[model samples]
Target: MNTDAALAALAALAHPTRLEAFRLLVQHEPEGLSTGQLVAASGLTQSTFSTHLAVLAKAGMVKSEKRGRQFIQRAEIDALKGLMLFLAKDCCQGRAELCEPLLAELACC
Candidate 1:
């Protein structure tokens, strides 16, 4: 991801509700979750949760598809990977040993 795209993703995830929603979606993975399900999980009004979802979509971190009458939202894993790579691109100023620990932690996930 470029600097601007990375910034946008960061800004989108900076909000609590958005971060939670994104993580929830990630847990669901390829199957994803319906918009209603997300709203219910958030314990927020549909309209309010929609605004948060919109921010995630705008940042390219989330995507939605029409499934029957409902929209299923899915986390964009590639976008997340890109953001992570961008952040660690210059890890420890090119010191491989210094970056090993960070890589190991990510590997555990």
Candidate 2:
């Protein structure tokens, strides 16, 4: 991710509602969540949820699909990972070993 992308992602997640919605989408993974379901889960009104979703979609933090009358939203895990990678891309200027722990943490998958 570039600086702009990272900033957008951070801005999208800056709101509490959007943060929780993204977490819900992440937990649901590929299955995602429909508009009504997201509203129910988040305890937000439809209008409120839509605004948050719009911000996330604009920032590339969320993906949405039309399923009949409902819009299903999914967390953009790759984009989020890219942002994290971009932030740490430089690592230690002269000490590669300093990043061993950070790299090790991502070894889970």
Candidate 3:
């Protein structure tokens, strides 16, 4: 991805609450979570969670779908992988094994 997109994604995840919400959504993958679930999980207020969700959606890190009366927010995994690649594109002069553990976690999500 381009530098600006990367910066926006990183910025969207920079905050503690936002990062936690994003990570939770990432971990949940396609299933995602409702606003109330995210609010409880992040311990954030409704307005705060809405703001963070908007930021993430604008960054293309997440997408929201309405299911009945509630909205389900899900992480865009491909976009998240792009962010990870941007951050790790240049790492370890040699011995990529040093970063293997970090990369290994990618498979978990």
Candidate 4:
């Protein structure tokens, strides 16, 4: 991702609630979760949770789709991957050996 996009994603995830929601969505993956489910999990009012979701959407870190009468929210894995790559693009300052350990840890995940 470009610097601006990376910054936006970072800013969106910087909030505790947003980060937690994003991680939760990631755990759900392709199937995603309904808006009500997310609000209940967050223990927040629907409107409050919606604001957080909006931030994530603006950052392209999350997406929602209309499913029947409800909206299903899903984490944007590509956006996350881009953000991660942007952050690690210069890992170990071009020293492959120095970055091997970090890559190994990521591979485990």
Q: Compared with the true structure, what per-residue lDDT tens digits does model 4 show for residues 1-109? A: 9999999999999999999999999999999999999999999999999999999999999999999999999999999999988998898797899789888999999
Q: Which segments of candidate 1 are over 4 A away from where they belong?
A: none
lDDT at 22, model 4 = 100
- Judging by lDDT, tell me the better candidate of 2 and 3: 2
What 10-residue stretch in candidate 2 is worst by lDDT?
85-94
Order of all candidates by TM-score, from best down to worst? 1, 4, 2, 3
Q: Candidate 3 — which residues are off by over 4 angstroms?
A: 92-109
Which is the leading candidate under lDDT? 1
lDDT of 4: 0.95
lDDT of 1 by residue, 1-109 (tens): 8999999999999999999999999999999999999999999999999999999999999999999998999999999999999999887886899889999998899
Clashes of each: 0, 0, 0, 0
lDDT (C-alpha, whole model) for all candidates: 0.97, 0.89, 0.88, 0.95
How would you encode candidate 2's per-residue C-alpha lDDT over 15-39 as one tens digit per residue?
Answer: 9999999989989999899888889
Which 10-residue window of candidate 4 scores lowest in summed lDDT? Answer: 89-98
| Residue pairs of candidate 3 with colliding backbone atoms | none
Q: Which pairs in model 2 have colliding backbones?
A: none
TM-score of 1: 0.96
